[model samples]
Target chain A: MTTRERTDVRRLPEKQVRDVAVLHAILDGALQAAVGFQVDGQPFVLPMACAREGDDLLLHGSTGSRLMRTLAAGAPVCVSVTHLDGLVYARSAFESSMRYRSATILGTAVLVPDDEKLHALEVLTEHLLPGRWAELRAPRAKELAATSVLRVALEEWSVKVSDGFPDDPDEDLDEPVWAGVVPMRVSYDDPVDAPDLAPDRPVPPHVRALLDRS
Target chain B: MTTRERTDVRRLPEKQVRDVAVLHAILDGALQAAVGFQVDGQPFVLPMACAREGDDLLLHGSTGSRLMRTLAAGAPVCVSVTHLDGLVYARSAFESSMRYRSATILGTAVLVPDDEKLHALEVLTEHLLPGRWAELRAPRAKELAATSVLRVALEEWSVKVSDGFPDDPDEDLDEPVWAGVVPMRVSYDDPVDAPDLAPDRPVPPHVRALLDRS
Candidate 1:
């Protein structure tokens, strides 16, 4: 069983969701996460492509990066992923807010062992760009050596969901204004071929599939 | 003149951009930022709506929140904003990456005085939901009291932009595979009217404009 610590929602306790499925949904849907770690009391947040494999989230970066090195050393870190669904418009500024699903995990990341490094990379590539892992050339030994894969177990995490419509006060609801949601989404456009593409090479079926799915 | 320290890019130095204008552009275009701050060695990253006013970036949160209180106390913080432009696919898994423009700022945040708190809130509202600030009712005294606005000067920061096409090695480039970028964007759909909206109240002109702009 998964146990959580100080992951409770203090500000908006009503919005805190404790279901594990909800946590997985947030993790699987997001393409990237903002990783938070500190160096000499100064915190740094970097954007990274994230992949959720079973109980742990996989994050990869250049082994030479200070943040990666710190994480490999088991420094405390926070992995946060947020999806902005829309802008909530209300009659009053106080009630106006955003509709988002955000999940934050607090833990130390352990570097994936050398024996499993290639498998971790496969998980990341498949998660970030589905079906491309099978099409692309696998990472060579040198490439794996240059990359650092950190996996943080999903032991302590919190998921907050704000998916409701604007909730303005009764008095404000009577105001002659439109108060609702402006839904937003991220979409993929047509893929552009590389400049030095070999002749007779067409966009791969997997790439074309992405457009269809989008 | 702005002085920067410890903002140098250590890994992949070619992607680092030191131009202040580029920093401003990244800050101005983003609707939200991931705020990183450490408390007792456990780091937390929260999603925050950001507004760039002059040389300072304003962030607001509940006054009762610990993160807000810590930041108000002038604790070191890192505010990062990233815009994902596209997904880069290469012939090899090692060469594949995402196209993104990310900016990270390191500094201490000061609480905006009570007198200036309202203006700071307005800046945040306008930046996040452009043109909606003027239409909504201004915050009441109680609401203003419950909110805490903090400003961090952009004196030390760095930006990393990855806009180039896939840079696969010669051997991989000749592989009979498609390698290019699939453009991505966040856009808004039609506004969904609230169920309890006043009868015959039309969507505001400002809200309607969002769809067109997107």
Candidate 2:
């Protein structure tokens, strides 16, 4: 079901994704998002760490931020998550492009209730760093007091998935250059321990696990 | 040299970068950028392939797009480029964050002139996938007519670099958990040939170079 007025795909209708699962996957796979809001006639976009909890996307910013305050008051915002998948090299300059999955949500956001602030923070922490939430110390009261958490319902959104090969026109196919997708993958390097760590402390199992998996 | 009003780094002042070289490097290294503009008080952020040509950042969109049309008329916009460097695991949830290099440029954008549209496209192609612009067929007249290229001057911008280890509070540092940065690197996989390629055609040297370098 698409919110036809707000979430309808206009430019590339073929790449539009309406499945709820696909939208969730793109959000879950990304560690960060670009959040945009306008002040007067100018728009400001900030790259922020984000997390999706069930149907609402959670984002945190300094309590003193004007943008955060504007968003907390239910201003319309757009949160966009993009995963760059590959580089598509076609036989023509016009056809060459990138492979990416991008989801854009357009809606007004409300501030998270004070009672759920800690839980929201936990959701954000766990979603971003997986197992680190349980191992790390809980947020202090002052820390929680200084942060603002906002949630935008996933009601009006559009997901565009472009994972296919380059679509060169029939005549351009024989242009005498190789054409294909060069897949881009992100690999995690070994963790570098903090310089201030105790001499006896070693890289923990959680950090080591990323090395093995990535 | 700092345009404090527009480019001030508000959240974490210490991480703010004012060097033009670092800003250029971040833009040069990125293949895409999230461009944000507002229409009727609602902000829209779209992912588009980007190229930095000297002091102007070039982005192309369909001529029929409302955003593109507004931008072509010199609407104020925010173009943000972010490179996610790693995940920072700290001793406390409050201290955990991501390491990234982010540059945000705030300015009005002008449409590239008709005469220079092709050159701008060439700049984008060469910056995105080097060594292939000379090998590919140039865009046809109809294709050029359908594309809209906009350039934003890099006059007022700020770069934020967060590359340091987790800065956990002193008391939390002994929390019995490993803390460090898990670096994320993007690498290219072996090229997947297009399905319709001629049997005798091979992956070109330009495409093979990415495999060797990445």
Candidate 3:
């Protein structure tokens, strides 16, 4: 949160939203986030699975990875989560755009100490997979050693949403062409059991619930 | 492609792929990409609609924006496109991961000249909207003036794909617990016409084709 002024959306100011709930909503809805960080003035962005817990965004990766080690050591980072909701079909190619909700956070991360690491993992698992966490076995000590859990606070952030119709000029709107939004969404297919799973084992309810909601 | 060595995937070398076809497939399947660029020592990653034209990744935005102006002027950039195919369920949390195909291209962008701007726009439109570009009206001169088109070559890049089942150890595999991948995909619902459109006008074929594919 060092440079607070940089978080403002200068391109399309009207799309900029100042609501914390909107930020949290976008983060909660997204499964992964693109994290940007610089090393020796060169920027690197990698996609990582993420979950939101309270006012923080939880990220986990192999402790051996350079990104995890650098971020865990409190390097400045930019985390962004975007959802492309739909495509806006305008009468003119210039006015065409996409409907999307995005949230970007600017700050460093705090490593989850060894004592609280398990709880943090639990929070992440439950948020992403929901009821399946309780059904799964506990993580072994060796498994925990190889992973690093870090949390970035939602202190300095900006959320921008473009969900409405395209703002075409009055002249363009009168054209005989058809124009509207083509809605898009994430859908889940049937669960594919592992080849190693016993044939008698049935798909869990929590997993089925995901498809139902979809 | 300034530091050529930096393009190597040092973290997960096993997942790193050197095939150009894989990179093209990943970029073609994705709708947007997270572009990272450094200003001073601060890093920023923003999601932008992207299209792949030959060996170049085409990007367009308002010429007035700081990012567009900076990237258009040949600033170093790292563009990443990731498609999360499914969630991998493993016996232990340590071995779990997502099935994804990601391509990272590192280079500076070259601005498309005024003469080629319209062609670049057409390429982008056709890639995203498919057959709709032929039906849409041509871009006016004013609209072209307000936009900036830039293309980044896929010269120094890396493709990483993790599409297999979880790589759990032999001991963990013996457990009777079920584990597998829950497939995920982007689906489209029925397209809704604009409220301002003529009530009798029917939906276009190209837009409907998208839903059919989904």
Candidate 4:
């Protein structure tokens, strides 16, 4: 599949993936993104909480911020999400690399209308905290007013996956060094109660569910 | 201390950090960064292996990549490094957030000249793989030729940290919901040997050192 000039992974074209499912998989498993936008010909990239809803990727931002204002006004943005899966240790420094699943989406973000803002908020909150959204109180009107939800259609994007073992050349194979992948993953530590929390409050099952993942 | 207009953390001025040591600490502990650069006003953010050497942040890229080529020509770039430390579960979804250490550096990236490319390469490799650099064979000239090392001065940078407990309002305190942080950390799984490796090869001490860290 031919991608537009912008979404093309020109550096390692072989690693570029055109599959929509792959793109969704990367987005579905991600909660954060480094969003890039240009201001006065200079690029600024900042971390933002994100969620994918239907065909659009939802990004939560402060309405007062420049990036959010620019994005809400339809400036082009690049959202990047990456999962560093492992470290590939080859026999030579040149051949050593990382195993990762990376996705980049390019689109202008449309501001969620005032009426849809509440639903967008639920998606954003639920996407990050899952079941906790149900037990939480509704967002205050003031809180909703301060939040900005920007949705970028997932129409133009690219995904790159590099998950193989060290691909050292044949000449470097006999170098008598161990070659492999040191797999990496994110895990949750025990939930720590807030300092002011009442002593009687037990940790919620929803939060405990985070640690249940093997 | 006043920061450059570009480096100002305008979104939440209170979260901006000025200490150079804090900036270095964020960079030192980080290996992956989302580097943002522009072409014809369209911003692009790509993940790259990074290392901080003294006052400069070194980013590794393929010579043929558009980002590298643009940076090599002294185009402005923004490099963002973030460690998502934990999930903050507040009583209200509006107050929930994440604990993170995020740094943003904005500057023009200068291409490391040919004479210093090897040293830059070492910093990049050693920063990511640490002791593996000393154990690996040297990078061949062709390999060196294909890699581009761009250095962005840490001069124009801002670090924002959000590591505290969820700051729910006083009125929301009695909501009878568990509120706290679910800490997150990255850990390595046992190393998996390359399929082509000899069965008798043992994992190196340097690689095992990775797992030894607390």
* TM-score for chain B of each model, two decimals: 0.95, 0.96, 0.96, 0.95
Error of 1 at B214 (Å): 1.8
lDDT of each: 0.87, 0.87, 0.85, 0.89
Per-residue alpha-carbon lDDT of candidate 2 for residues A64-124, written as tens digits (9 for 90 to 100): 8777887888888999999999999888888888899999999998999899999999999
User: Candidate 3: where is the Cα deviation over 4 Å?
Assistant: A1-4, B1-4
TM-score of chain A of each: 0.96, 0.95, 0.97, 0.96
- Quality class of the docking in candidate 1, CAPRI style: high
Candidate 1 lDDT over B1-214, as tens digits, reads 1234468888778999988899999999887789999888888999887889999999878899878988988889999898888889888889889999899998999999999998999998988788888877778999999988889999889999999899988888788777889998888999998889889788888888888987
Q: List the lowest-lDDT window of 10 residues for candidate 2 chain B.
A: B1-10
What local lDDT score does residue B179 receive in model 2, on the 0 to 100 scale?
84
- Better by TM-score, candidate 4 or 3: 4
Model 3 lDDT per residue over B1-214, tens place:
3455777887678999998999999989877899888787677889887899999999877889878987887888889898888878777766777888888888888889999999999988887778878888889999999988889999989889988886777788766566888988999988878778755567888888999999
Name the lDDT value of residue B123 in candidate 2.
95
Candidate RMSDs in Å, in order, are 2.2, 2.0, 1.6, 1.8
Candidate 4 ranges with C-alpha deviation above 4 Å: A1-3, B1-3
Candidate with better DockQ, 2 vs 4: 4
- For model 3, residues A1-214, the per-residue Cα lDDT tens digits are 3465679898889999998999989998988899988887668898888999999999977788878988988888889899999988888888888899999898888888999889988887777776767766789998788778889999989899999987888887777788889999998899888877756567778888988988
Candidate 2, residue B23: how far the Cα is off, in Å:
0.7
Instruction: Provide chain B's TM-score, model 2.
Output: 0.96
